[model samples]
Target: MAKVGRGLPAPKSKRRVKYGPNVVRLVCEDLASGMTYNEVTQGRGRPSHSSLYEWRRRYPEFAEATDAARAFGAEVCGDRALEVAEQATEETVRKAKLEVDTLVHRAAVLAPERWGGRGAGLRRAEPIEVVFSVRRFEKVVGPDGRVCVREIKPEGEV
Candidate 1:
């Protein structure tokens, strides 16, 4: 048995599925349509989640394609949220609000650069100038042998 994590034997699969272009295409298309990875993999003949991840690790192009698909999916979710909100009836208003909230949250997480809240991806650095004054107290022995305090100011200031 092949060793997996922490010396545990890898689970045996009942079937071996081969990776192919068709699988990639199906996954990307379904994902672009707003289907979750779990949902897409649940279809018949679809690669298992583990297998899909393995393929991603082994293939760079697959990873890039899936990433783009997910971003597109995020936009789809945003659109769906709008549709849900617009079609909400008094009876279904609460349910529609919840659905819209969930979709918006998903879009924010999936494509933060576009749908994330303020400060998600847009930030500008500006120079800040700070001005301050410092006062120093010095203890002095006066001619009367009594201690006196005087305030000393920093250079370039009165």
Candidate 2:
């Protein structure tokens, strides 16, 4: 029988240890510093890429940080979109108001008794219907105390 000598009673099986914040921070910093996943794993010696990926997935702090960064990016994009929308709305409202004012002024000048003089009750003009195929007009109150569009019927047309 061949004599098989046990080598130093075989080293005790080490318990699997969860890495602490410091280790995770070090790995994250290394990654941020342009170290690849393979390089980080090789340098840390304690964790493999798969294990590190799992830890990052399981860790709440890491997940929260990632989510926060993503939210910030989204917020920036949303703010830009909001700014553009606000500007366009302002311009549209300004243009609409100007058009309404010009039309009112012309009506007042042409038919002072119908539109400008005292006791000049509500008078309907020709029903001017504008069709917008691409854009729809949103009914909005203007600074002037009147509706933007007042439907007017043609003279003597019931």
Candidate 3:
């Protein structure tokens, strides 16, 4: 029989991100052009998403710049949505509306202060619907002889 070693595997070294002015500039440009954080972090030679977040944590200026760039990206997405709406025709109306809706949703999430929750731009197609339910509780004895409160289903419910 061959002898097998029982030692732990070697630890992999972490990728070191090179911080530079151009790195920040390029990241900001992509963000300002409406690219998401995951999108920006993709591809070879780019820093991982966590590294970008770490940089933001390490440098307050980078955080602020990224925040501003994200807001600009939201605005850019909003503009693109508007353009899509403007160019929609009878045949393309459904697809155009879907694209515009997606872009507007992204914009609203990215920059809530600008276009979220009844703001001046691009309100949702339908008003939000809220439902309320009253749950009934009943005391039940468990197999362990412990009493616990359980939810009681309403009548005619399966």
How many clashes does each candidate structure show, in the order listed?
A: 0, 1, 0
Cα deviation of 34, candidate 3, in Å? 0.5
Give the per-residue Cα lDDT of candidate 3 at 112: 88
Candidate 1, position 70, lDDT: 90
TM-scores for all candidates: the values are 0.67, 0.30, 0.63
- Model 1: lDDT of residue 96: 100
lDDT (Cα, tens digit) per residue for candidate 2, span 18-57: 7787666666665444344566666324567667678768
The TM-score-based order of candidates, best leading, equals 1, 3, 2
- Sorted on lDDT, best first, the list reads 3, 1, 2
Q: Which stretches of model 2 miss by more than 4 angstroms? A: 1-17, 64-158
Off by over 4 Å in 3: 1-15, 120-158
What would the per-residue lDDT of candidate 1 be over residues 1-158, giving only the tens digit for each residue?
75458577775453556888888999999999999988888745878888879988999999999989999999999999999999999999999999999999999887777888866657656899999967789999999999999988778868
Residue range with the least summed lDDT across 10 consecutive positions in model 3 = 5-14
In candidate 3, which residue pairs get closer than 3 Å at backbone N, Cα or C atoms, i.e. clash?
Answer: none
Best by TM-score: 1
Candidate 2 clashes between residue pairs 3 or more apart in a chain or in different chains: 125-152
Q: What is the C-alpha RMSD of each candidate to the true structure, in Å?
A: 6.8, 28.6, 13.8
What is model 1's C-alpha RMSD? 6.8
